[model samples]
Target: MWDSLVLGTKPYKRYYEASLLTRYIPANSTVVTSNTDSEDLRSAVFKTADGEYTILLEAKAGTDKEVTFDFGGEPPVGKTFYKHVYQADVQLEGNAVIPSASGSFSTGAGSSFTDSDIDAEHNVIVYTTLPPQTQVEVTPLEPVVTAGQAQQLAASVIDNTGGVTWSVIGSGNGAVTAEGLYTAPAVDEEKLVAVKASSVQDPDSYGIALIRVQPAPAAGRADIPQFSLEYGKYAFTEALTITTATEGAEIRYTTDGSAPTLSSTLYTGPIFLTTGTKKITAAAFKGGLEPSANVFRLYKIGNVSAGPDGYDFLAYDGAEELSFTGTASIAYGADGLFFYKTLTGPVSTAGLFEDPNPASDDKRYYISTLIQDEEPAVTIYNAGFEMPVTSAYLTGPITNGWAFDYRSGVQKNGSAFAAAVAPQGTQTAFMISRSGITGELIQDINFREGEYELSFRMASRPSYGDILPFQVYFDDQLLGTYQPNPSGSFALVTTEGFTASAGYHTLRFSGIETPQESTVFIDDVRIRPKGSPPLPENPQPNPLPEEPELGPPLEELSNEGFEAPVLAAHRKGPFTESWYFNGYAGVHPNGSAFQPPPAPEGNQTAFLQSVSGGQGLIRQHLEFKEGTYNLTFQAAKRSTSGGRDHSFKVFVDDTQIGSFTTASTAFQPFVTESFTVSAGAHTIRFVGAAATQEATSFIDDVNLNRLDASE
Candidate 1:
């Protein structure tokens, strides 16, 4: 063996060996020995006498060829091949097949090969790119390539792989083929290839055909096949086998027009489509591959399961397209109602429900129900009062009346008229008792319905004893008139129908003395078919359906702090009577307007409810810069004798929040009052009283509102 056998090679790879095979052996001797095949140079294996075990020969080639590999953990888009390639070299003690010589070559076949001779041998990696113009003819080459060959994809054995290596063997974001094989690297529309055949010593180097991988033309798929479904396929047995230019690919069938995802099983066979002209569509694809769509129309009978006896799971859009398409199935065990539904129209009528044989558990049928709702009750509004019921008989004396005589009907118990239920006290008044100090008598009566009759010998002694003609009033309205017999005997003013209807009503009596003698006196009073008169005006009115409103004004609570802030004081009380908020309210507990200091954070402005209510001129003054204020008291009645009514005069310095209205004698609940104060605590009071007639009145619910000054 001689070093001259090999030449022009440096930067050799390091190695360890059992014994030197090239130990100066004779050039003529057969210096070859069976080696582990992976050993890089298999130095000239020749042993000398005495077994020194040394031989010399050709120098080894450069380091092994560097194969750049790449791949994506995705399926192959193009018809890339994979084949398992095991290293073919003489195995060294450590199995390290350091290449004897290697250098990249950009010229001459795009490969680095050793000079070839009878005994020349070499290997090296070089890239060969399939240009954009290279035509690809995907021939199922190797007629017998797939026969029980530990079958691996052609992409595996990319020995001396020249094109893109997305990754080296067994590495990086890459995917193995279904056949358990990996391809070279993934290149963008670039084609790298592996060779099935190459010369032995041609560096054992391989070359790939330069054909651009055009993302493997997406296999054109046959439309979702419309089946001539026959009895052989009683249960829709056809695979709906969508034939595509691709094999081993999957079809995502959407028989219900629903989107098919990875979770949807592959369309291996026909699916029993649901009722209504079935529309079956399929999207075919390989992993990370573009999708091809196929749509097919077919009729599937609702055979396996009994659908609505009259319809084929009714069609919603229209009854014209009711049929079972093979994508969905009306299988025997399926549960649920399949009819088209709508809110407004009759999807299923009452009669359509097959009696569900409620008597037995096994019996099943279709049934539906109807829902009806009641409308809201109507609210009523009437300015006039209301009397719910009517009935009664006569009962009572004819006292409480005024004879309209200055001598007897004076504001002090002077009687000229009579009344049934008028204000009986205070400055305001009602029925008078007597007239002229003589005997001017009056009669009180009730109406059959909302009306009343009055029969009295009324006489007016206007001046000392001067009698003047007078009239009677029914509930403040003047009725008929009558004259007086000085003796005041029975002067009938009503024989019958005189009292219109039955209800609580007022009757006034009056007449002229006609220069009369003794005071007039009347008698024989009667009232019947009575009805409790409606109280004055009813408050709440019926509101329009769409125009509801909560009109009460709201006030800020507990407002405090300083600088300046807006403040609205609120006051609540019986809407019926007027209130007097005398400054006395300010001094006493019932009218307390307490002010508190500001909170620390109040850098902003602060204000108070400078407003108030009082008698004649009273109110919650804006105690900006405080000072003492005076006050008075007044709970006096303002009604006529035998009657009662009250009104309050509230003034805020001069503004009034206290309004006044007379409280009628008709049945009514006592009311409450309230008000809002500024950003501080405050005390408030309620004055109570009544006239010389009935009992006194009282005010309650004296509340005050305050707010935080800052916010």
Candidate 2:
């Protein structure tokens, strides 16, 4: 029996042919049945002469009484077959035999018989070659990818041809090229993508890699705008166009000095601005993207106003009305007030009388000012501190019609009314002592239901490296606070727009003295009518909303860096549980006693430097339900007086946990520690360890994160 197996290769192909023409017959006998064991042929491994290539082959029944060998699917090239084929029941011209023999063939070498014989019955076997066993190894077993991003992939075969074909398993998942570069789809939905790499040498063998698709890129907030014209005044008309670089972005704009929102007017064409000054602000918006930064432009189309030097004003004194006519002038009575007048033309004035009533018909006064002044008014009794103090220092609360209240000390300080320092015509002025104490100086004044301006002269002597601060209150309502600058002469301090009803009201100068030794002097405390003094600018709107009423201090703690820098170390100020620094015994870090350390996370860090050897303490109040939380903070230490290690103990409420210490001046790595706070309000504090010498300890960036109860 004769059977033929063909394995052909193209001219330029790198593989050789895998064809064999086999002539198997009984030794020296006529051709008959050619039966072979199918199992043996199927399990045979075919290889080349040099064993460089291997393939698996299967044996099957061929037509016309012959056995055929099948290479799994297609005949693999670049190899020869040398495996033995089992023969059974061989018949040559009516003779049968039960023996088996081996046969061989090569694609380039041709078929060959193992032995030659004649006139004998014997089994004939054929050589078998196996198809190459190929496996593909893909790089990056699993990878995370974002939508619309491309990733390069690689595949290699183990002990076989390295060639591989790449493809994606499903539709709309993404696209992959033959070279293994995959490009994800534009959709943001996350999905798992299966990429396959099939071996070219073995069709049935492949490798799969899972690509984890992540969400789309984030659309961040927009950028601020750029203006074509510089911000300044111009005489001629100018055309302005609002533009943003973001593609397909729409610009919403406002020309009325209001913030621009999505519902504002959409900008399409250039804005033709003429005449008056206008403020143009614009913001960009796009679908699926965050709005761009806002751009602001102020265009002054006409002449811009200047400071006080811009105009001339005629000056007149009290009870003196000799004025050659002009539109604007300054009238000096008990005070100096700006007055504007409009007339047919410039002319000499008749005797002008000043009106102090809100509903007055004074022709010389501006109608607005005259109408505002029409309300009844009164002057404070002994407006200036001209009364003599009963003694060198105030021994009691009441003296010279003024009452004093101190935290713990007597009302004692130098008098501004003394002959040496008092201004030329002054006789007596009150000096309030500020020596580590809290106090208030007050007086009662009867007002007739009118708005008034309180003006005074204040001076202070430098003390404790800080200016002493004082607050003014009217009828228990805080009006303003004052910090008198240490000048050689007195500076004027004034507060306006103080309205009073028809009754007696208490005015006060209250203060909590600093650790420094300072004194506040008061003279010429005058209260006058505020008859429409050009109507002070509108009060600024509060940037922060009013905090909700929190029961039992449930509000979260804020301002980790002591908002009051003076609270650092042992220096005194108002210390609250939210933030306070004090020391006892011996633990103190050495640095500035009052100032914070250099380069803090925020404006300042609570720097506890050992001035006198004692334990330094810093505390914060926190309220929480029963829960576990992570406490994190950054700490730093330095040597100021001695090289004593700056160590501090951490505590939740009053119970101490572990301690932290660093000897270098640089800040330590941010550390996190866990602590459980039982239900209710608690305090987290850091106390410096007691040391004999000075060392500096710093703390900043304190945060607490709640954890799950099960964790």
Candidate 3:
């Protein structure tokens, strides 16, 4: 490699140092020709790993000679090159001697440099064209300054002298002193001023600080208008009222979906809304003060009717196609409304509400009549693969509404090589087939007996031309088998109308194994009535409504009290009957080994112990109706040696909805946020961890119940 040697001592005659070569020429550097024609000089060029070139020149023991050295390529114009000269005439201090003369020169035209005065007799000259590396940072990057106020700023330069020159950018905005003191202009209007600090050593390097200048507060603005009724769909005509908290403010409103101004219609009383959708924009204003910010609300007015066939339909228009009699509650969805009511006969007009806007051919309404405690259609949970927010890929047993088998999980689009962007959301479900094993994702859906169609988006990894084979199945019947085009983009695939009975049916997607491993991405899976409009293309789901009052516990989960396969006092074991346990988690009876409070429901409780810096998790799958429900449980921290506070997380499928931490030795009841599940199977998981090993959390008496109308 690029290394040199020299020998001698005392007067350092003909002395050569190995450290000199290793210091300038790095290991593995290639030695190249310097292209110099001079009998009095010996030269070598080296190319470092970072593409930097270093030149070494030695003048023989003779008269001084001028030499011209050529670099391979032309150096950047005005680029500085450092030069270090070690002369035999200079006195050596110790084993490590400093260079006799050190300076730098900039390239003016070409990459060649001619040294006019090169001392002879054991002279070493090292030349490198590496640019000076410097970083300038300004303190108080963003500061709020009052009009005419001064703020002190500082500049810090790394790898160079700390001296800097401060200057302001905005004209007539502000000024900065040489000492980095910034003063805002004496103006009433708010403005932003940029203060720059340039490095004294490197003029090209600098940092800027933004200063916000605003006038002092004078008076508060009027309060914005508020509506008594919340926005969204309504089944009947409604009266809306606008109000403001500002004492002497006047409310102005607009009904044509335009911004409300001072000259808009004045609000005197409640406004009545009949049919069709309306957008109300309102604002408040008071004399001698600024007008309040405008508030906007959108309301879709529709009508509900009951047909003679015992089915109810909610229509967007006033057209009365069916007779009305019974009272029904309304629920809102992404594209339409659901009229839920009890009926005596089988549903024959369930499809009537499918198309609410006949003129536009928009299917906006749906009828979910309760026939023998069963509804025709239910919502789908996590249908867009948007749960368990992840940045790259996540795989485990807690996928919320979906379960994975083998090499199947959710992944963020564009996170890995060849992964394409999801067609609907930021994440998609991926199934891989490798080693003659097919990866699958399964979800059990509760659908009423009706004709339905299944649809989803599918794509293959980008640049991977292999045909990804996949199949969709409902229960034991295969709906369709597909081999997506290798275009690397998603395409919507829909199955023909299929009949489904009212009960829990396993819906599965399988990536078929082939000679070559393959991967298939699935997103936005949907199942709708045979002819119903496809869920609004790439629709954003509506936020869940406030949970209603819980009526009674639904016997949906097994071993809620952790009493099955009971263990003896002071004993613990993996006795989970209807639940899945991961890490150091299982059921344990109240014992003295780990002092725990009395069981909230039974003699035994589920326990999760953190060990080896790992968290413990317990999860169970349960079926739920399409409504809001409450989840209640009791948790306590185990009193034991090396135990600390326990932290717990609750998840419905892949989304973590709530979490809590417990340090109390006695059991405490905890009611989590309402979980609104579509009528289907969903996984409920609890993950617990503590700072120290052997820390355990005791959980018991977990219950979930659907809320009723009466709070």
Cα RMSDs, all models: 47.8, 40.3, 29.9
Expressed as tens digits, the lDDT of each residue in 1-711 for candidate 2 is 211101001111111111121222112332222334643334323333433322233334442224343333333443464533333232221011112223344554333222221112232234434432355767775666778899898887753665888999989999999899999876533456889988887767787777766556445744444455644455434446566667788887775557778877666654544434567777878877777655565665532111011121222222133322212222312211223333321334454434533342321222110112222134343344433222233433433445645431121123322322433112234334445565566767656677887766666655324445788888878878887776635676668568888667888877646775555655556566774343222212111111122225536767654433321122221123356544221111112222224535543466554322345656666677788886677767653333346777888876776677867666665544677777878877677674433456667667777876553
Ten-residue region with minimum lDDT total, candidate 1:
380-389
User: Which one wins on lDDT?
Assistant: 3
Task: Put down candidate 3 lDDT per residue, 1-711, tens digits, no spaces.
Answer: 111111111123233344345556767888876555766777888877767766787778768777766554545433455666766556532122334225666556756566776665667887766543465767776676877889999988754675999999958978899999998887544456888889898878787786767554335777667678656565544557789878889998766567778877667755555444667788889997788766666676543221111122343332234221222223222222233444322223444345322334323222322222223254455566655445567765544567766678878754663566665545678888778877888887756678898988888875653556988998989999997668877778889888888666888998877887788888878787888765444443222212223223334888899876544322222223577655256665543234467688866788876543456777777777778877899999876433467787889888886788878889998988886777877878887645423367889999887675533
Error in Å for residue 177 of model 2: 88
Instruction: Give, for candidate 2, the lowest lDDT window spanning 10 residues.
Output: 5-14
Please give, for residues 1-711, the per-residue lDDT of candidate 1 as tens digits: 111111111111222121111112333454436332334443333423332222222323545332322222343212211211112243422112222212221223221222222122352211111111111111222111111122233322222322222211223223434333433333323222322322232323322221112122323432222233311112211213344555556666554456555544355543433312344545566665555444333443222222221112222211222232111211111121122221322223333333322232322221111111211011001000011000111112211222222332222122233221111111111122333323222323322333333322233322233334455565556665555444322233442234443333455444444434323223223232223222222112111112112232223212222112211111111110122222112111110111111122322111111111111212232222122222222122212122345444333332333544345422222222333334432222233222222222222222232223333
Query: Residue 478 of candidate 3: its Cα lDDT?
Result: 94
TM-score of each predicted structure versus truth: 0.16, 0.22, 0.27
**lDDT order of candidates, best first?**
3, 2, 1
Report model 3's TM-score to 2 decimal places.
0.27
